[model samples]
Target chain A: MLEEVVSGGGSLIIIDDINCCGRSLLKCFLAAAAHKGDSIHILNFDIPKDELRAGMDSEVAERLVFHDGFMDPLNWNGEAVLPASPFTLKELRVCIGADASPVTLVLDSLSWILLHNPVSAVCHTFQHFQRQAKSTGLNVRQIIGLLHGDLHKPAVVDSVCCLASTVVTVTQAPSSEAQGTAVVLQRRKSRKIVRATEYFTILEHFALKSLGQHQPLMKLAGEKEETPAAETDPAANLTFNLRLSEEERRAKERVLLPYHLSAEVKSSLLQSHAGVAKIYYEPDAADDVDEEDPDDDLDV
Target chain B: MFAAGGSMASSSFRRKVGGGLAVIPGTRASVHNGQLLVSTGASSLDSVIGGGLAVGTLLLIEEDKYNMYSNLLLKYFIAEGVVSGHDLFVASAEEDPSSILQELPAPLLDDFHKNNLDKEEKTTGDLQKSMKIAWRYQNLPKLEVTPAARSRFGHHYDLSKAMSSEMLQAVRCHTFFLPTECGSAICCSMGHAYTLLLQSIHRVIQQEGFDGSCPQKKHKNILRIVLQSLGSVLWGDDICCSDHPQYIHSLTRFLHALRGLLRMSLSACVISLPAHLIQNKAILSRVRNLSDTVVGLESFIGSARETNALYKDYHGLFHVYQCPRLNSLLCDVSGTKDLAFKLQRKQFTIEIVIHVELQGVLRNCLHLPPDLSDRASRSSKQDLSECSKVLNAGCAAMTAGRTHLDF
Candidate 1:
């Protein structure tokens, strides 16, 4: 997913399932941005700032700037929660400050912001940030937003998906641990639409490492019947040896016709036989002899 | 044919521009920048689609049962760009495109380095010489020549060595992550997503100055746009319950507009949709109409017939459901019929199967000197007398090799 984001210049990415998707996606983006020597700013609206900071790998830690709004929600005299209105959003943007180099903005959770403000208001503010991020002169390369799908209505989710350039959804595994979590990453850029799925394991610090491949599990029962154990048994397997027995070999070597005769017959057949063609039928000599000798036979 | 195109390009006197669109040399209708064609990355795929996908065309790859095989092709497409230094615009809805690109298997050539050191120790090294047959096959008599008017983009890829770090570094990628959260401002509407994607791509193309007008720009680049997962339920569509038709309609509109956008710029697009997930033929056909090439892959996972002995030799069936008429002119349609795809450890081959009767083939070839070539040995025949029998036997053996089920 980070590759998709990095390939597309100045994109706004939304990861819908925060917990299921894991913070590793965030770390991945940060690592990529760092690889490109781009500055990184992550708004912490879900996890505590200290833990998020502690989990950061050294590779991308120095490049990252965390906005600890979740730990310390903006409040007016400790009484009212500051809504994620344009005013607060503006304040957040200003607090991050401007850099000459490109920066990647990571919004930890859009659901947290949507909780405080209505969908339309939040969307409008989002458009503002996205435009700023995508602006030609701005150092903002891309903006990544994380949201929880279950918390909002389908229409609202649809709107959010539409607003972003790429959408990745993480479906959590059930508590039984029998199945790994499924992550579907989709990108719609111009006419090209691509989707990929991976099963991932949750590690320490909300990290996700994908399982090697995403092949569907085979149904054992169905496969068992197709190649039953009894049929596959070693005793049941047949082996054929083409080696001929001594008697058969002798029989094959025995000439049915002499080589000279065979050659003469072959040559003769090749040359047309013009004289033997006139007789369509002839009376058998035995039939004529029987008719002539009927009176002399011992018929009495 | 390429020499002719080169000559035409050099003369410039015969150059024709069709309504501001660069008329690709020697082609009647394939209008694009400089007549350059891009590889679909997999040679098997390239052959299936006639020539490599023509510039400015869209390829729709629909997945069957599971997305494993189709996604592999997608990986090939992206990895090809990385290797060829094409600018990539990847908008992924599921996994980070970066991670996918990172995990892509290095092309077979990467192993050439490792194998080179031990070359002297192996007696089987000579086999590599025979392996170049596919590469040499191009020099064969033009059995089914795609006409000169049809620009051939026959850049065959050795999938094994196609991906490398140097090529990846050369690639300029514009990657956007679409938000999937319900009710998030970013995930608001399908139309907005399509619009935002188009705008981003337009910005990418214009920035590169490869929008076909800037011939002065020494670096000619093909903008490759890849979108992953068109109709996954996570794309904010309740595809199962209701609103399915609305989602399909929106997707069609997006693709239609995208196809229109490809014309002005030197670009091509590849999109993969999970047909099993969509579960609607009408919508898929509608999707099909928007693409120039349509390739569908069906693996043996769900069907009971997959277990049959006949299919045991095949990994899957690849249907060239549609090919651009331009490509059809280049390749024999019969050559692509009854195509089965078999994936080896390093590569995949798409070929027609000819099933010969198991009996008599070995005996005939071994006993007789084999067909007309045996005329030299026929003079020394042990039997000169049995002319008719010898003639009949010789005739029977001569016709033996011709019998087979071609389909």
Candidate 2:
């Protein structure tokens, strides 16, 4: 789902679970980002550099420059930098690559950075990153930032989401402990958020495979049969709890009076009004025949 | 029986009876030529917004939960433009509008071809007669002797298949992909998005050799301006949050200016806004008031009770909360404004239904038992007499006061 957008050159922010699946997802993403021939830079804050390096094969590791963010005062893997508190955007830029030849920088964990720095600072850093990534000269291809949702405030997560062009949240399955979790991808297209959900399992060699083919859980034949039955009986699933008597229903129908019965009285009244007014000394023929007529000359 | 006339005759009779009460003239819907009624792709949507969308009007669609459905409607608007050969101006502050256009689904040609085959079976002489009548129908109002057959513009699209590039090529789409970066800060500011939008449209109008000064050209080709999503994070201002104090002012100003721009040109605008993201009902209501028409799409698929009650097979509830009354010339065409939409593979259907109110109305109208009815009747009579007595007492008091004043 993300291949088209990520490859096309944009920034993406992935908010994942605290479980190991998130780390596995990052590894898989790095491998994919590297295969695209982008100059890869990994800022590893949660896991040790050695652990991440040992986990991946030399082919993948050789393609990535891992920045150690866990260490106090943050070592840049032997790179020189005038250290600023909580890592300034200028210093981060030097680490990403001074001469950007289609660079893809992966911030493996953002919650660690947020723990030390304010959300506004992190937001500004990302703002600067997007500016660089989108520029024509820098040719900074993609910036993939990973964050753990369990460790950060939702406000922080949302602030980061606002800065990136695409946001992916890897939600763990409630019941399935062994099976992979749901990978919900939301991309900002034409100022609209287009969402697509898929399930992913991390495989050996730091590769990710989608769990199932994109097909409905139920067969098409069953759906066609079920729809007609439901359509014919809209109340098939509804249960009526309010009880009403037959006389009550009749009275109700009478009060809510059908238009046909009411229209007759209106039509006659309108036609009579439209004609000349007349003083009727006797009853009209339209009057009920069963009723007795009263005398007209009563003085009382 | 005096009820000799069926619905047709009864309707005419009623019209005569109510003629004195008729404050507004009867405006019968005509064909594509004279009136500026552009179809919004979906026939139900057309019905919802009166006969069809009026030129020089703005339609604001408030999106439901995820916004994908509203986006589909936007696509339908563009597809309608493409099929009708209207020039499209799509402005976005995020992704490329052209790429989004590429993602529009193709129309279902199977039904179209079948209808064409049926049309071909009609004799050429009959076709010529109909054609001659169609030309006359546009110029004149419906004569009492004959019924006027309404001609509809635009096609019903099938979103199951990929949109063919051939059809896309025929549409003239102008896209303004506003960058979110600060280097183009002046241009891409969400606060200035509406200004930039107006400028782009102004440029288009000027470039097309259309007179922007006259501001009253009623008969010209239609221009479609689509703003994909407003008030989203991607279209953020210098400050990122969408709820900045200036955001509302900027948006309302944009809509007002856009409406003014539309008035002079032969153009209609469709905008999709994420109400969920804005999360402010006051601002949302203001936005609704700013546009000519407002439609809301609410999905109840996630709720079990709501699903089981009536909307099990339906996609969502399509609400026509407001329809523009332009000089009272256009009558509300949709017999039932509120509808339930069901999107199938081939075509989507919007049906009218009243599910939740049946029980409520039934309770109100139910009759009492015999004993209860007797009691109710006696009480009502007593209540009426008591109310009249009170009124007489009040009248007497007023008369006494008048007499004292006279003295």
Candidate 3:
């Protein structure tokens, strides 16, 4: 669906958390857009400027616009400076209207706004932004909202969902041990696409890399073979005790191959050469092989 | 008589009265020969240790962000030995040997392959002929080597003879690359690949009877066990040691076992410990006691005075904090703080600053709903009550608190 939107010159609004999934989606979108020379305008609300800068290329840094301010939105204290916007809806309107079109507006996070601002006000502000973006044909407008179990209240989530065209829940998968975050999209009101999960990690500098790029997106084959009891319900309270045996299996496989070979080598050496003598590889052949394989012809 | 939950019968109390040193199980002798060689690849690290890693000693290399450096050093050591005709056995715990082999510098890999081909050329005519026949049998299409054909040719292609033929071929080559298949039912069930590798090396050394009786035999039996990201193994309760009560005991025992079995006059065992473990005094003491010659890599030392102080305090525990370049990589507070107040007195242009900022837009949107606070704290009863009262007082008090927002 995201691919279709981008290809069709439409924008997408992704909502997720900060740790893995949301960061990965944003990274993929940024990488794809940058590679295609499509303009990207990121308006991160949660991540600090330095952190974001550290993660992105200097060229991409040039494309990013950061809005930092003083005063807590919830308390309205003008003294304490916040990392993100402290603007009112009216002020936000002015900022959005002045910005260029065919833009990809990434809120970077909505959870911050919800936590700091009144839910009703945030919803209204989002609706207002949506109307403005629709009027401008901005192509894509993404408002990434991080939702931890402790912070995302149902009522607040519902209000935010109502304002979004599509809702994606980016989360850490149940069994993945790669420090990779996964995303699960739920259209909520729209037609459902296949429930897909993609794994990603936040690389140094807040830049995200998708682990699913080279590997399969999900362990569907393993999941299918396992009994239904193994299929965990995401909404259920997660227990850390749930060990992924497959991960252990993979680790074990990595350790054994060398031992088996060493044994074979040792036994052979003992039998072939006098059992008591040390086996040594004749040295002259290496020099001959070097003479034969030129720099250009080397397989490596 | 220690009774359950009895204060007087506590294990700690018993140790204090006896004044007996804690028996750390897996703690291995740090120096096998007199020298200790800690390999960090960087010159600064080598210098700090007063030289290269001790020959026939076990050196633990900590894991850093760029694991490539450690991997490179492992390959360098192995390649140096292989090319020099020194039989070397490398048992990698964390990564696949195939993958590691693939990542080895191409020229080095070519050298190894060329060396193998060289040895294959030196076999006697009959043995070479038999090897060719074995190779053909091993690589023949599965259908061609059917049970009926095997039975018919059983006299000519004896299974044991064929197997031994391949083994002989591998042994003739000094540089044998064994990619560990750790998870196979037989090995993994017994222990993790690292432990198994250690055990195998121990067995070989024992079989060879290299009890330091012959220095040449001892040097030739040197095996480099690379347990990458040992932090992963140490964190999980994968280490097993019988006599010692503590985790450190098991770790030290494992190391000692390797030291004795490998006949390592000088062997380097690289183990990466989690940042958290560095804080534990017991753990530090254990690691300190385990190695007679210690060299810390990537340590943060604030000033010469502080560093001197640490040396003065833990003089017997460590030899040197070496690798001042390590200070540059110390990003965490423990690294910084330990160096600043505990180790060094010189303030090398220390510029510490804190930046606090708020996030998201502020709006007085349709004042908080009457039930807003109540709804928010519905998850807990006590919170629900507090929220109800707050909600009833509608916008009674609004204070700024750190709240992480996710959208």
Candidate 4:
């Protein structure tokens, strides 16, 4: 999603939960965004106040917009047991809409809000935000929801998927095993059209990075080729005209050379049968002897 | 001398018979004073003090379950000194001397009785048997045992006479019970008592020198100087938190004096501080700074928090390498290893993986948005969520492949 947005020539990026690997993500995003003259805006929920200022470079910090208060959900009145804040939904929509630049808006998590608020409210608010972003022609909008084995709760998740153009599921694989994590990206409610699964490994922290670049995207070996019926075979349609590039035709000929046949003269075969006359004369003598023997046996 | 040599040979024989090896004293040797021998009960503690506490050093034994063990060791030291004609002065800050004397193990009591019997040969079997019977009955009331024995012992036993006899001969032993609540106010009084004891000891040493020969007149003068407990007068309704600072300062100064001016050989000072007092960061910080050795006794109430904070502070100071439950910050051992094990064992309800890098990033980001200061201008929920998402993604990506990306 990030790559798609950057490739699409999007500029400013507002990404949340970047703190987790935000610094590294910012580095990568900046590297990519720098090419397109795009500025990255990172908002981290978890970074301590003092360090947020001291640790980040002044240049990056200028573009960075952080919201630290989100750490204490009580500040959002999330502790009220019900979603009471009238401004919450509006604020969410406004935040989604505020990116005037060609930007990708990344929401790090929807899990906290879903857990705190009614599922319907979260879904309604998220859907509204999604529609607003879509209408605004925002270059790219990426919302990463951390689903910690709670994808089974389909109410909010289903709503999220419905509103999202693309749903990427990032999971951590068991470290002791040979297999690493598989990041599956599927278009919303359309499994057939677009389903891409990429393998990723978790390194030192919970930062997920791609596997080796050299690994093949597809593996197809030990497959049996289906034999074509004679009438349906392309090779059988010799009379049909087909256009091919010179390079392609040369490649085709190289593939088809092994099945050609050779024809010898029929006269050679007729000359080989001339020494069989004695066998033909013995057949008439055997017939006369059989008739005489049968008459003599009958008289006795 | 005879007893010391016999014990030494017996110990050597036991070691040889047990392990079939000649024991080598590694980096330590025992010191002897004429016919007297003193050994610290624990080798680890003994190694630090260069042959244990000096003979005349005033030992403060805090009352607790461990007090019994410490007192028994003190008794052994006293017995050694007494036999060598060096006087032992015991000042109990808490327990009753009679009760403690009664609770003394039979072997120890028997040794005292034997010493008494050896001095006063005229005391026959009947009197000896009566004295034994009386000693048995003395602590029965204090003990959760028979009530009849308490009265019987109370009637027959002369505790003062017994104590005097124990302190008889060239070795004069004095025992005083000074019980004070281990609080800030009491700490001040204890500090004063400690100072006075040091000053007197200093005076005695100056006049008589460290040599084992102090004249009887000087010894009498020393014994006449009484150390009184101001606990009862200090315990009044007027006590206030305002007095705490003065007490803390005085206590710190007193400890400094003991450590510096007195220059007395201290084997150990078991300080029994009230849990609440130690929990006060100001008081504890001062105490920690002033004292090298602190034996903190925490009661059941607020024990967990107090113990944890104490361990943390002490661990920070590099005083303790390991505590039973608390992690030693000074040690290079990974605390995460313990956490991971606990997580694997299902010891806690929640497993929290603190992403330090993310935390650092969040700290950097928190200062943004002047609205964050004005609660009304707080960033929208969408903004916060986006921030959370970017942080998670970045963290995941970085952990996965050391990838650096701007969010």
Pick by lDDT: 1 or 3, better one: 1
Residue B61's lDDT within candidate 4 is 25
DockQ of each: 0.01, 0.05, 0.01, 0.00
List, residue by residue over B144-189, the lDDT tens digit for candidate 2. 3322211236566877765889988977888876653233332334
The residue pairs that clash in candidate 2, if any, are none
Candidate 4 wrongly placed segments (more than 4 Å): A1-300, B1-86, B92-170, B174-195, B211-243, B261-279, B288-292, B296-407
Residue by residue across B193-236, what tens digits does model 1's lDDT show?
Answer: 66666677777777776575555255456778888766554343
- TM for candidate 2 is 0.58
Output the better candidate (1/3) by DockQ: 1
Alpha-carbon runs more than 4 Å astray in model 3: A1-300, B1-45, B66-68, B105-181, B184-195, B208-221, B233-249, B262-281, B292-407
**Candidates sorted on TM-score, descending:** 2, 1, 3, 4
TM-score of each: 0.46, 0.58, 0.30, 0.24
TM-scores of the first chain across all predictions?
A: 0.58, 0.63, 0.52, 0.45
The local lDDT score (0 to 100) that residue B325 gets in candidate 3 is: 19
lDDT at position B292, candidate 4? 38
lDDT score at residue B352, model 4, on the 0-100 scale: 23
Better DockQ candidate (3, 4): 3
Per-residue alpha-carbon lDDT of candidate 3 for residues A1-300, written as tens digits (9 for 90 to 100): 434333323224455544434555566566555545545555455665566556567666666655543123333555433334443444454454454434555565666665675443454445444444455554444443344423565434543453354454565555555454444333322122233455555555444454553233334334232242466677577656555498887887677543244535544643534456766787772233435434422222
Error of 2 at B338 (Å): 4.3
Which structure among the candidates has the greatest TM-score? Answer: 2
Best by lDDT: 2
